[model samples]
Structures are given as C-alpha cells and as structure tokens.
Target chain A: MDALVIGTIIKVVLVLLIVSALAGFGTYIERKVLAFMQRRLGPTHVGPFGLLQIAADGIKLFTKEDIIPQHANKFIFSLAPVITAATAFIALSAVPLFPTFVIPESLPLIGGAIVPSVIADVNIGILFVLGMMAAGLYGPLLAGMAQANKWGILGSARTAVQFLSYEVVTGLSVLAPIMLVGSLSLIDFNSAQAGGIGSWIIWQQPVAFVLFLIAGFAETNRTPFDLLEHEAEIISGYVTEYSGLRWGMFFIGEYSNMFTVSILAAVIFCGGYGDLGFIPGSLALLLKVVFFFFLMLWVRASWPHIRPDQLMWLCWKVLMPLAVVNIVITGIVVMI
Target chain B: MFEQIAFYLFSFLTIGLFLVTVFSNNILYAMTSLAAGMVLIAGFFFLNGADFLGVVQIIVYVGAVMALYAFGMMFFNVTKVVKEKNTSNLLVLFLGVSIALLMVIMFLSPIVPEAIFASVPPEPNATNPEAVGMVLFSKYLVPFEVSAVMLLIAMIGGIILAGKKMDQSLTKIEDEIISEKDVK
Candidate 1:
C-alpha cells in the first residue's frame, strides 16, 4: 500500500480506538467525579478504583438484547444509533488532539513517515467539526421520530431546538477566536497561542471563551442544558424508546461529543496542543482537555437542568446577543 | 485514483438520495434523506478540494437549515406531513431539481475523462482556508456583504413571523385561563 494510504489508515484506526475508549472512560470519570462531589465511593468493586468499569459497562451494553418497537420504522430505528456513533467519530477527524510527529526512516514497513495529529487536516477544520456535531442532532431527532412514541418525539423536538439554538452561540463565540487566529484550522488556532500561559486566546477573548464553554455544554447536551434528555420532565427524552446497546450508542456519542467540545474549547480559547514550559505539546493538550472534561462533570453534578422555555430564552435573548456583540467587537479589534 | 472513486461514489449516493428524499412516503424519512443528500453534496465539494466551501455547505445547510426543517416537522402530525406524491407541484420540483442537478454534474465532471485525466486537480486551496477568506473579502467582498445584509433581513422577517405566532398562542392561553376562572 502507498505510504499516504497507510498513514491515513493508521490515523483513522487510532482515532476510532482511542476516542471510543475515551468515551467509555468518560462515563467512568463522570461517575467518579459526581461520586466524589456527593461524598460516595463510586464503583469500587468493578476494578482498581473502578478503572475497568468502562470495560464492564461496554460488555454489558454489547451483550444486551436489541429490541425494536413493532410500529417503528425498522430500517431507520436501527440506523439511528449508528448515525450518532458514526458522526461523533467523524467529527474527531478534524480535531487536533496532539501535535504532529514524523517517524524515523529506520521503521521497516513505513519509513520516514510523517503522521499529522489530525486524521484529516482540512482547512476549515473547526467548521467541519461543528458541522458534524450539529449533524449529530439528527441521530436523536430521527430516533425519537421513528420510535412511534410521544416521549421520543418530544425528546427529538427538544433535541432540535437545543442543538439549533446553541449552535448559533457556538459559531458566533468561536468566530472571535477564528478572527484573531485568522484561520479556521484547529492546528492554526493551536499555533497562534504558542506563547505560554499568558498567550492563550482565553486571556484576550475572555467573553468568547465563557460563552463558548456555556454553549458547548448545550451543544453536547450536558447538564443544566440537557433538556433533550432531562429525566424528570421528558422521561429520558429521545432515548425513551431506546434500549440496550442502541441506547448505549447515544451515550457514547454524547460522551464523544463532550470530548470534542472540550478539545475545541481547549484549542480555540485555551492554549491548545502547544507545549507549556517543560510539558510536551501532546501532554499539555491532553491536560487541557481533561480539565475541561472534569468541568463538565462538575457542572453536571451541581447544576439543575433548565426548563425548555428558559433554555430557548437563554439562547436567543441572552447568549446569541452576547455572541453577536463579541463578534462585532472582535471584528473591530482585528481591523484596528 | 482514490479521489475519482470517491467522487463517483458520492455523486451516485447524492443522486440516489435525492430520489429517496422526494419519493419516500414517510415525511420523517424523506426529510432525513434530504439532510443526508445535502451532506453528500458537501462530499462532492470536499472531493473537488473546496474544503472551505464543503464545510460551509454542511454548516449552513445540513446543520442549521435542515435542523430548522426538522424542528418544523416536529410541530406537525407525521402522517399529515407526508403529502401524496401525485401532486403536480411535487412532480415539477422533482423533475426540475433533478435535471438541474444532472446538468450541473455533467458540466462539472471531467470532459473527455481520458484526455483530461487528473488535469490540475480541482482545488489547490483545499489546505488554505485563509486563501478562501482572502478571496471572499477581496474579490467577492461586496456580494458577501450583500448576502450578510440579506440574511439580516431574513432574520428580521423570521422574528416578525414568530412574534405574531407567539401572540396568537398567548391569547389562546389567556382564553383558557379565563374560562377556568369562570368555572371556578
């Protein structure tokens, strides 16, 4: 096989394996964090400090029976989970998790191979990632509509509004940073912030950073904004009709999206994969992502989900306006 | 070689999906297919090396616009939304869009494939979003600004429509509360 093809294949497999595992591990992290916050030992029996719990859950989800509603559109019902899972994974292709590295020529099959951190280094990297994540709304939307259940439809409806409204905030808030960086590529965003702690875009675009973080939670359907799957009101919303592994796919997709959002926040606002003092680029990037992930869990544990009306009200009346103002200010700053 | 194969595959899927989007009996399924088809067109842009345009297409069309369509669908009864396919308007749209799509595809596809096999690959700017930005802000600046203005107008129009709807709903809710008070 050609070297380019081989390199691309390697990146694809690496992204798929590492990200899927991270998604599962995210559940473990969430449980552990929420547990700690509430003063409880979370899943101590599963594995050493419950590190292997993700594996256990994975097995359970996989082995569980796949149930289909009799009235559901069989093809679409089955396709929904795959779409969520697939799109979640696809979005990661543009995200630069680590810095690029080149292999030494001593390698046998592959010699002097340069492997970029990203699977696809498309120019419009951030936009592609946002697009893929937004497209993720369809998974739950379709799943709910196809399930032939009222709760499913309600869940999907909420999903649509939640994803759509937050999307404007996400794009507008991120626009400031993109304008500052002058490139849509995530790698460019990272490089533009290469000057240590103080050089991070967050320091400059503080409002955009905060707005993007809040909007990120809504986009990922995280707590305080997780109206799409709010258990108390909507009865698990879009997943009301989902079960077993099918339901697990949504979980995985959500977690993966969380990771994607965290990565975006870290890269666009915080210093991205750039090295900080002694820390290597990749490790620094991972640390930023880990911090963001923990923040999501912390918010989830402490905050209550908002009402649907409030959710929309916040999006349009507050967040969107804030984002637009931020963008305009950013444009002026860039021009000057 | 891989690019050619991908182009053919994506084009084929886009055409097939358009057919599915129009012909499907389930409005839910049809809308979903339409979203997928739009994304597949983005695939063509990606294949042609217009990465910026491709991502923009997905962001604007699939992400924002289609989600609006899906949300609109949510308010309607699913059974009622799926209109009978025999309508002349539907037929006209299907025929017109398909023909236009095919014509564009044919014109865009490599002319005399062998004679111009891989002639100066379509998009050199694929790796440079900044280049696209430069061109847009320089050469196409006026049109771009005009489009932004148009979008602002559209936003105002949407707000007006939504505001009227809200007023109607609010009055209805007020009527219900008043009736309950009388009963009490």
Candidate 2:
C-alpha cells in the first residue's frame, strides 16, 4: 500500500511537470512555425534559435504585475484562472502518457510498484477527460463575467455557445469509435487498433474522425473557432481584464487542452501508443502527438476565425447531423 | 478512511455552496455557487467509485446545463431583474427553515435508518456504466422508454412554443368577424 501511494504521487508529479513543460514548448513551436510562414523571425535571440525563450517568457509572466479591475468581482476573477489550470492538469491524470511499467525490485521505498500508463486509468477514461475539459469552460465564462467589461461578457457568451454546441458534436462523433472499441478507456482504444495502421478506427469512421477533429478544434478554442478571444473584435475577449500570471494561466489551460484533444484524437482515431511496424509504442505515440499538435498550429496559421453565427451554424446544421448519421451507420455496420 | 475523508469534504462543500446558492441576494453569486455545488456533487460521485456517473454529472450538469443557465442569466439585463422585493422576510425565513429541516429529515431517513450505514449494499466489481446499461435496457426498459418519450414530447413542445404562427391560429368566430368586417 505504501509503495502504491508513493509511486502514484511520483507519477502525478512527473505528469504535471512534463505536460506543462511541453505546453510551454508548444508555444515556441507555434511562434517559430508562424514566423516561418509569415517570413519573420520569431523569438530567436533568447537562446539557440530561441529554444530557451519559453523559459524567459515564464520568468516574465511570473514577475509581471497582477492587475484587477476596480469594479470586478475580486474573488471569482482570481479563482477563475486557477480553475482553468487546475482542471486542465486534472484531465491529464486520466490520459495514458505511455505504456505501464513495473519498477525494478531493487528500488527502495517503492520497489516493484507497477505504475499504470495513466495516473488514474478509470473505467471511463475518455468521459472523465471530456468532463474535465468541458468543465474548463467555466474558467473563461466566470472570468469574463467577473471582469465586468462589455468585451468580457461577449467573450463569455461566445465561449458558452461555442463550447456547448461543439460538445454535442464531439460526443456524438466519438460514439461511433467507442462503439467499435466496445470500451470507454483510451487504453482499450489503443489496443483495439494494435493491428497496425489498417486497424485504426479512422479508416472505418473517417466522417466521425473529421467531425471529432473539427469539434475538438472548437472545444479547445483553436483558430477558425477562436471567436472567444479574437483580438480584432472582442479585445482579447474574456481575458481582457486579466494580466500577468492570471492571463498566463488561461493560456496554459488552452495549450494544455489543445494537447489533451490531440492525445484524444491520436489515441481514439489514429493509432495511440500502439506499435507501428519496427517503431516502438511510446515513439509512435509521441509522433502522433507531434503531428496533431502541428496540425493545430498549421490550421491556426492557414484558417481564419469563423464568425460566431457561422460557428453555431456549422456546429448544429453541418457537424451535428453528420455526426449523427455517422453514428447510425456505424451502429448498423457493427450490428452486422 | 480515505473515502470517508473525501466524502466529508465534498459533501461539506456541496452543502455549503447550496446554502450560499439559496441565501445569497446577488443573482450572479447564487448561480456561481450553484455551479460549484453541482461540480462538488460530481466529486462525490467520483469518491463513490461511480466513475462514469461522475464524469456524466460534470459534463451534463456543470458543463452544459449550468453554462446554459449562465448564458441565460447574462442575456437578461441585470437592472431589470434586480428590483428589490418587499415581502415579509421574517415569515418567509421561518417557513423556509422549517421546510429545509423537513427536507433534511426526509432525505436522511431511508439511508441512515441504523446506527451504521450497511444500507447501500455493494454490487459486484463489474463496469458500472455497462451494468447500468444492461439492466436499464432489459429490466427497466419500459420506464426508460417512457422517460425518453417524455423528453421528446417536451422538446417538441418547446419548438412549437418558439414558433411565430400562434397568433394566426385564431378560432372560427374571430375569422368570421374579420371576414364580415372586410365585406362591410
């Protein structure tokens, strides 16, 4: 029991540290990618090709002044950011980081502690992750309301609509794959796709995969669906009043969520941490994560943010119906 | 021991928030508190090892429902909704307290019958959602279908209510009067 408890604590700390560092690194990659696309040098002077720039940014964010609007709800404004960052990290607890491992018996206090890939491989892992990510909506919603700015309210309203509508599409689209795998655990999805590339659920449920990806983008507030904080109109939206670490917390939440969705997409549709030919399981998983993360950045660079009305229209009229049909068809096929 | 501690923590939070939700004069605080209370209940579900239920509770209640509620709250102009009430607060307070106490008793009686709670007998260590699905589809299919049909009806009713043709559905007497007036 002691070993189990101690091992779990170590795993939790490891996940929190690594995922956060990767999220910071993701920003650098986005900037570099965007810079290259726009023919501009982005953050190159800080370190070797700006590699340590994220570290510099972290220092700046931490040291920056924390500002609160005079009329704002003092408690919730502060509470909101913590909720965002906390929920994002909490969601990671359910995500399978890599394959499970049994500690060598030679280790002292926690010898032979068999660590599961995920921190909490719950029976319904996907649902738990989705729930946590969905709960993240409150961070922005409350933030906007608490900020007491017109733009903040508008941003919160957009966040509510975009998240609520896309949530339906996300759930429905994933239903087909969940049905195919016959389990809600992401590890099960990985195992179901273990028969190499051909066994990937994406090959069978391309429509669902596409819908899920689109909804995933909206859910994460990525570009083409980033009406929540479009600088051109809403003046940074729900985060208009926030500064310093508080603002950085929202960004971390978003980037971490982006990572989560990428993992979900990769695991459920693309082969997860499953072995691909001579490549190992963990390496394959990492490659998929990189691809999905890059895809988000690429889409951000290429696509324009859709209008709020258009986002709602697409979610309800196009994606929802498509997801439903995909589910029904998959259901029929599975029954056969 | 762990479960007990967690249960106490979550339940305290849930009830504390619920109290604020009811007693607070500020609409926004009340609504926010309600959301917090709902989320804490989801935590309670997690502590009970109802993992799927926990997730669904958060997703459905806190994520979708409370968000929608917040959106509705934002849509209404606050000044219009914030008009002070001039009712007899003292009487209302007494009645409210009594009703709340009655509710506490009613809710606790079945589960807390004995000195100890051996009430909630443990089921097998099967996947909960799967077991729920199986039993719901097999034994309780009728009630399940009935509730589903109820929801469908309510949804259609809402759509009809939201339509613009209600005024055009005047009875024959009104239609005849309109025609007669036009003829004159």
Give the 10-residue window scoring lowest on summed lDDT in candidate 2 chain B. Answer: B75-84
Query: What is candidate 1's local distance difference test score?
Result: 0.83
Q: How high is the lDDT of residue B133 in model 1?
A: 65
Q: For model 1, what is the error of residue B150's alpha carbon versus the real structure, in angstroms, after optimal superposition?
A: 2.6
Model 2: which residue pairs collide?
none
Model 2 spans > 4 angstroms off? A104-111, B67-98, B107-125, B161-184
lDDT of 2 by residue, A140-254 (tens): 8888878778899888888888876788898998999999999999889988998999999999999999998998999889999999899999999999999899999898899
lDDT string for model 1 (B69-149, tens) is 665555665533455645588878999999999999888777667655642333454355655666778777999999999
Q: What's the TM for model 2?
A: 0.90
Among these predicted structures, which one has the highest DockQ?
Answer: 1
Give per-residue lDDT, candidate 1, residue A68: 91
DockQ of each: 0.48, 0.36
The residue-level lDDT of candidate 1 at A288 comes to: 90
lDDT of 2 at A238: 92
Q: For model 2, state the Cα shift of residue B49 in Å.
A: 2.5
User: How many angstroms is residue A199 displaced in model 2 relative to the true structure, after the best TM-score fit?
Assistant: 1.0
The residue pairs in collision within model 1 are none
